[model samples]
Target chain A: MNLAQLQQAFRRWLVNASDESAQLLGSNHVGLAVYQNNYRAQLVGCLEQAFPNLRRWLGEQAFLAASITHIDNHPPHAWTLDAYPEGFHATLKDVFPQNPDVHELAWIESALNEAFVAADAQPLALEALAELDWDTAVLQLTPSLRCHDLTTNAEAIWSALWQETCAPEAVMLEQAGGLLVWRRQFTSRLRQVDALELQAVQQVQADGSFAGLCEFLVQRLGEDAGVMQAGEYLAAWLGSELIVGVRDV
Target chain B: MSTSNPHFSGYGLGLRKEHYCDFLETSVPVDFVEVISENFMVAGGQPRHILRQVRERYPVALHGVSMSIGTAEGLDTDYLRRLKSLVDEIEPLFVSDHLSWSRSGGFNAHDLLPVPYTDEALDRVCANIHQAQDVLGRTMLFENPSSYLAFEGACMTEWEFITAMARRTGCELLLDVNNVFVSASNHGFDALAFLDGIPAERVRQVHLAGHSQGRDILIDSHDSPVCTGVWELYARAMQRLGPVATMIERDDEIPPLAELLQELSMARTLGAAL
Candidate 1:
């Protein structure tokens, strides 16, 4: 037989195998069944890791069903399972439209995985700040550090997942809050942040000189929000090792 | 980093997640460790950190299941990139992947699917291997996967195909002794002849694993201890091939480190005898 017929036979056997009565070697069928099932299972298991939130929101059966369906049309082209789930959200959103939370949940979960493997680096500590001359010191977050200004209460929902009790209402935070995800000491952590503080850090990180930051905040949040309060927030972030470095003056 | 020779990292066992803690807490005399590259390919994690610690001590060799050299769809680039990154990080003594393909198009069965030994198939496999070696910038090794079936179109014996692949592609062979036993049993081939036909220079590494029998066929299940027949094959392969880098794969029903070492020690003895 030529390679084409050989390829066809292998492909057919992979799809479905018959018993040994009609087979040249009975063992090939067994290997195909077990190997095929495990191969599909690897992708499904990777989806569980990449989209834990979607998995939780959709529950076990529905989530696995969605995963199984997605993989059927989009068998993994890459050997690394990490990249395979990169396109999962688009597929899930199309399949489960009525469940709008699915998109947000998938987004948060994917971002969480992203943050989890961002890079290996150290975050700035408060001690690093103490040595800085405050007037000229411009704090810079680590490259691995990212603050997600979310539109949905992803944090609360994720927190509820940790308790092994997942209820949507449990995450009924007043506003769609902001989130900060950063990797330090090779561990990833995420948390909700206040809106004013979120924008405050983002603005400074984008292009705020310390004095300019205070002036901008005075104009935007009213003079009643003192510069010291902003400094305190910065200090708190620094203490938690969220602030990684300081830009040159 | 501790230096390693491609042909010999002394005696090592397949790095099992089960015995990770054992290796971490205390150091044993095992010379090196083999890891399934797919398991620890991601950017960062406890798994990687542990792997880092392990690499600092023992020589690490990458054994991948997804290279799919036997497939007709050409080489998978994404898989090669990931494997390259792993090679950069781990610096395994000699990188190896299965001589099998698991998918074509979109349907990925994730099994170490067998490839037929036809001339066309051989050409594709050689081209893919050459492409893979070029990308990896190193001579890669391919293992003969345990088979469940043999197509009628087999142009030559499995050994003939592997030897031709190695010779054609400038790749090395990872002589999986257990696979020989399993395939020989399932397909009624002589395992010793399978060893005899392959050029010894091509075998840079050797694998010894355990297998279990199903209702009608024997499965290359890496569970339990290495069967007596597989041991005999290992001794024969080592005798013919001389001392090659040897390791054991115990993925299922993993025993304690001591037990695995006991088996590895026996291999060390066989390696020494050879």
Candidate 2:
């Protein structure tokens, strides 16, 4: 066979050592077995690195088994091992339908990884936000900012595992809420978001100008109270450096 | 490829996160440092920040593991683009990757998977190398990988395949002596003959690392110090190919900076003795 055909057959054999491939392997089949073992070990090692907290939460055996399954289904497409095991949380959900928290933990970990390498931008100062014309100004957020709505208490589990302390017992969320993740300088930070903040974040993401934001507030609260709440939320966002720029719309 | 060798030459070590601060704080006595190309392919992060700072003090060689040059489907142009951007930024002394395929069917196995030493495989590899050199506008060094298995219908030896590749593509060679020793021992071939087969002028860099012995075979696990047998082989290579860029690599179970420096010092002593 030619090189292309040989590579195709070898790829299949690596994934599953079938009888035909075994015969084609010819002498020193044990060497082929070593390649197979190294193939699995290296990929599993990459998954463990990408999701250390998830591995800790799941324990060694369960994590290794699940990662092996994930590898079979969704091999890495990117060149870097840092980018391996993408969409693993969805796989986790498939593997463990009863433990929804496992999937949530994976999501949180993945977002943190993203935040670590996201683009850099100097955040717009809080004082700058106050000077903007509330009626015409459009706020721009940091590019690294990410929000996720989850129904499990995954953040607590992540924090505990990260600290290397006794991890907290897993629990379901009382109500569906979300988390806010963004890079503050070189460090990535995560915090829980309430319903009001989630709605405001959604508005900002959907291209809500200051006027639209005040209107969103006025519709939720009375005109006077809405104006006050808008000011407070804007102040909080600017103070956190989540707001990176502003331009007049 | 440049007919001239690298201007800088001395013992070097693989840069790791544990030794990042060590490199930044004080000038490590090593002459140059090598880094994995994929780790620093980021837009903005501490890793890039650290690399920028570290590059100021020492020359770096970008060693890559995922080019998948032997794949029949084709090379990943996107990966090459990212790599070119990094090469432009780092201005490394050498840019190198393995002569093995890591990607097939749109999925990367992340290991240096071996390739058949047939004429067809050699053609594809030379084409990929030529294309990569054209895209980056710089010559690349292709390293030999430690193999656990050989194809049933290979047409030539590994050294023959590499020598032909270098002669045809005008690409230099990264002679991984530890990998030579590993593959030689695993496949029951003479390491000296493998070295003698290669045209020495094409060899631009040499890699020395450690391996582990499994029940039936040896694995190229670069976690420990260079073994005595590999060290003896390295001494032989130094005599045949002089003044090549050499490095001591340790990926897993990394020791302290001092231990690696000591190992690197041993390399210098051996080379000088020869």
lDDT of all the models against the reference? Answer: 0.76, 0.86
RMSD of 2: 2.0
Q: What would the TM-score be for candidate 1 when compared with the true structure?
A: 0.81
Per-residue lDDT value at B242 in model 2: 80
- Residue-wise C-alpha lDDT for candidate 1, range A12-95, written one tens digit per residue: 554444443225433455555655556576788889988776687678999998887787666665566667888887788778
Among the numbered candidates, top TM-score falls to 2
lDDT of 1 by residue, B1-274 (tens): 1122266737789888788877778887787789988877776656688899999888888888877787787767877887889898787888889888866764445668778787888899988888888888888889999987676657799999988887788788888999999899988999999999998887888889999987677888898899898888888888898877888899888988889999998899887886
- The positional error of residue B19 in candidate 2, measured at the CA in angstroms, is 0.9
Name the top lDDT candidate: 2
Tell me candidate 2's TM-score on chain B. Answer: 0.97
Residue B176 lDDT (model 2): 93
lDDT of 2 by residue, B1-274 (tens): 4343354557799999999989999879988899999888877878888888989999999999989999988899989999999899999989999999988777677788888898889999999988888888887899999998887778899999999998899888899999999999888899999999998888878899999997687889998899999999999998998877899999999999999999998899988887
